[model samples]
Target chain A: MNISHAAKASGLPVKTVRYYADIGLVAPAGRTEAGYRSYDAASVRRLAFIRRAREFGFSIEESRELIGLYQNDARSSADVKKLAAKRLEQIEQKQRELQVLHDELKHLVRACRGDNRPDCPIIDYLG
Target chain B: MNISHAAKASGLPVKTVRYYADIGLVAPAGRTEAGYRSYDAASVRRLAFIRRAREFGFSIEESRELIGLYQNDARSSADVKKLAAKRLEQIEQKQRELQVLHDELKHLVRACRGDNRPDCPIIDYLG
Candidate 1:
């Protein structure tokens, strides 16, 4: 299939597909005589894997690491576990930070009268 | 105070302070005759605010917007509320995605029997 087809099948935008290719995230299976990228079923699977990993909030670097592990036949489960553990810790940290912000914002929103008056705790906090 | 002092006071690295200035996130208060960037208390406050906003997971662009709100005395509380709401939504979405990934990883790890044997469900999942 063409890049567009692969993109559609993978649920990623054509531009994103091109970008992944440009960033060496996903390489085309082959190129047509006209120099357009071509993707086979395996390429589509790889694109899907990349897309799913991205949706899971893996950074490009993390995705690259995961992909490397995916390709290595002799890869140790321990290594994969370590990477997953690190990613989980990072995610938990982000969640904690977001929870704090969310709590603060909720408090501010609640404190604000949200009326026609200019007085607002939200503005005060921001300022 | 010099940029180094401001950096120390703000709990940011000198390189980060310079990067923030370079990216127009923070501006120096004044310039010395010797071409050194100088900061007063106001600059320090601004840097602190920027760092705090970053800790709250606001992007550089979002920080810029919030800074504008901070400076605009006549700004509507509604505008700030909207931005905060948007940020909250984004954070929630990320949290959800991360939660899903965390669950999947936990499942994979649990399925993997960590033993001396080479067989592993984690590697199977990755591959």
Candidate 2:
């Protein structure tokens, strides 16, 4: 299939697919006589894997590491487990930060009377 | 006070303070004869405000808009309210995305045996 077909199958934009190729994330299986990229089922699977990894919020570098491990038959499951644990820790920290912001914003919003007068606790807190 | 003093007071790095100034997020109150930036209490407050807004996940442009609303006496509290509501919505969306990723990662980790054998469910899922 062509790049567009690969993109559609992988649920990534054609631009992103090209960028992935540029960054060595997914190299096309071959090229057509017209210099366009060609892909097979294996290439499509690789693209899908990359897309799934990205959706899970893995950084490009982390995705690369995962892909490398995926390709390496000698790779240990412990290594992947370690990476997933680290990602979970990062996500938990972000969740805590977001919860704090959510609580603070909810309080500010609740305190705001939303009256016609200019006196606003939201502005007061922000200012 | 000097930029370093302002950074120390505002809990921001000197490089970040300079970046904020370059992006028009905060302008120095004045400059000394030696070409060093000078600040007053007001500038420090502005930096603090910017830092706090950033901590709340507001983009630089959103922070600028908040600062603009803050500076404009004629600005209605409704305008600020709207901006805050939008930010809350954005944060909520991010929280949802992170939650999904977290759940998926948790499931994958739980399924992994982490054995010495090369046959791994984690690799199976990734591959």
TM-score per prediction, in order, is 0.76, 0.91
Cα error, candidate 1, residue A114 (Å): 3.5
Instruction: Specify the highest-DockQ model's number.
Output: 2
Please write out the lDDT profile of model 2 over residues B24-127, one tens digit for every residue. Answer: 78999999999898889999999998888888788999999988877777877777777888898888898998898888888888887776655667667766
Superposed on all Cα atoms, the candidates' RMSDs to the truth, in angstroms, are 3.5, 1.9
Q: Could you give candidate 2's per-residue lDDT for residues A28-97 as a string of tens digits?
A: 9999999999989999989988888777788998989888888778888888887777888899899999
DockQ of each: 0.35, 0.60
Per-model C-alpha lDDT, please? 0.79, 0.86
Return the clash pairs for model 2, or none: none
Off by over 4 Å in 2: none
Q: How well is each residue in A6-66 modelled by candidate 1, as lDDT tens digits?
A: 9999889999888989999889998999999999988787787777777666788888887
Pairs that collide, model 1: none
